[model samples]
Target: MIEFEFVKPSTVADAVKALAADGAQALSGGQTLTPTMKQRLATPSVLVSLNGIAEMKGVTVGGGVVTIGGATTHATVAKEASAYPALARLAGGIGDPAVRNRGTIGGSIANNDPAACYPAGALASGAVIVTNKRSITADDFFKGMFATVLDEGEIITSVSFPVPLKAAYVKFDQPASRFALTGVFVAQYAGGVRVAVTGASNNGVFRWKEAEAALSANFSASAIAGLKVSPKDMISDLHGTAEYRAHLVKVLTGRAVSAA
Candidate 1:
């Protein structure tokens, strides 16, 4: 990696101010960014570390919503988010021990990797991402692969997920990286049902509306009987073909629903 000044601020405001400097980039777990930096794909002049900020670290669940601090590590979430077992289980399975200890939920969501698990859980759970500036819904925060709608110098403070009546996440993982080859999240609320799919589309995580409609009518694995996922918008990659990913989406959604 190139020479870069590292700043660890103790407060969110101070960190935000530090990040205001030109060519300054935020650093959390370093699981994703560090690798890219080593490859020389990213060359920030300064690195602002958020791990030192005490206010942005913890997890809380009450009043029907599970709130997790932006800097809270995956291991903490796995232990704390018991109110939403689906989300907690998802967190626990994110990566190996070291990654779980170091990776932060905010970092994962901010990066918005197409194969990442958080996006699908957030989208299906109808999470609200709180930032230094404002609160953004998961639907609006994610734009595309490695993209989000966050403004410059805006840091994620926490994420609040509405506890669902029933929800589950099932993923077909890519062996080497453990990133989802295809993942499905199914959530049933009193109002209706939400189904989100990830790691299968080039456009990134998207709602499986047809599956949602099917499950809304009848919430069961058999509800999705004869349901089809077209390969038109799915991703074609070295790990699997578009058709293969499409099939996994259907199968995984059914499994999630059954488990839920």
Candidate 2:
């Protein structure tokens, strides 16, 4: 990796200010960014670490919402976020012990990796992404693969998830990385049901509106048993074909509903 100035800021404001400098990049868990840096793909002049910020490192639940600090590690979420059992379970399944101990929910959300597990959960839960400047809904936060609406100097401070009446996440693992080959999160609320799919699409994490409508009417595995996502939008690679991923999406969504 290239030489870079590293600063561990104790507050979100300080971290945001530090990231305002030219060529400065905000560093969260470093699970994703560090690898990119080592590969010489990203050469930031300065690294602003968010781990030291005490205010951004805890989990809280109240008034039908579960709020998790941006700097909170996966291990912390897995251990503490009991109010949202499905989300906690999702956190616990990310990568391995070392990665779970180091990877932050905010980092995972910010990176918006196509195969990452958290995005599907967030989208299905209708999460609100809180930043130093403002709050954004999960639907508005994500743009596309490896893309988001986050501004240059803005930093996500926390994420607020509306607790669903019933929810579950089911992922078909990629084996080596443990990243989702095709993951589905199903959440049923008082209003309706939400279904989010990840790791299968070229456009990144997205909602399955057809399945959502079907499940909203009848919340069961059989509700969407006949539903199918077109293979055209799926990501095709050596691991699996677009058709295979498309099939997994339906299968996993059914499994998630059953699990829920």
Candidate 3:
């Protein structure tokens, strides 16, 4: 690992200021960052630890929206299943207990891994990413593989998601890593329906417009009957072929709609 300085800020303002310094990177749960550092992929001059900021941790649901603090761990969400069952299910499905205890929503979304489940949930729920500067819609927050709209020194404070009338997530996990080979999140909101697919595409997270159209017409599993996703756009890895992952997208989407 590369040698680096560490700064633990007591507030978001302090963290942001510390991050504005040269070669600074925010450390939330360190689930992805730590590994990247260990592999010599990220060699920051300073690590701004957000754990010291009390404002960046917790979950709040009210007025038809759910706001999750940046530092809120998956274990907290899983343990408080009664608040949001679907969210609890999503959190519980993240990884083993150790990972769930440390990995955070902010870290996951900021990293925006192609196979991460939180992105799917955010997209499907029409979540807004609240950063130190401005709020970014999920559609604009995620750019591509391991890319996002976050600017240099910008910090994600929290994420606010509109509560869907009904929603559910389904994923086909790789047995060894528990990473989603293909996962789908289906949601029926007031304006319309949204279906976000993760793990199957090179684009990281994308909306299944065809499936959303079908579900909007009729919110039912059978509604996805004629929806066919082209494998041309999906990612092909050792876990599954592009065609296989595409098939799973439709299948899991149907299951999610049914479960919702």
lDDT scores in order: 0.93, 0.96, 0.90
Pairs clashing within candidate 2: none
lDDT, model 1, position 214: 88
Summarize candidate 2's per-residue lDDT along 203-232 as a digit string, tens digits. 999999999999999999999878878999
Model 3 lowest lDDT segment of ten: 79-88
lDDT of 1 by residue, 1-260 (tens): 99999999999999999999999999998889999999999999989999999999999978999999999999999999999999999999997889999999999999999999999999998899999999999889889888899987789999999999999999998989999999999999988899999899988888999999989999999988798899997899889999999999999999999989
TM-scores of all candidate predictions against the true structure? 0.98, 0.99, 0.98
Find the candidate with the highest TM-score and give its number: 2
Clashes of 3: 0
lDDT of 3 by residue, 1-260 (tens): 99999999999999999998889999999988999999999999999998888898888888877788999899987775445567778989998899999999999999999999999999998899999999999999999889999998888899988878888999999889898999999989877899999999998999998888888989999998887889997999777999999899989998998888
Residue 88 shift from truth in candidate 3, angstroms:
2.0
* Model 1 spans with C-alpha error above 4 angstroms: none
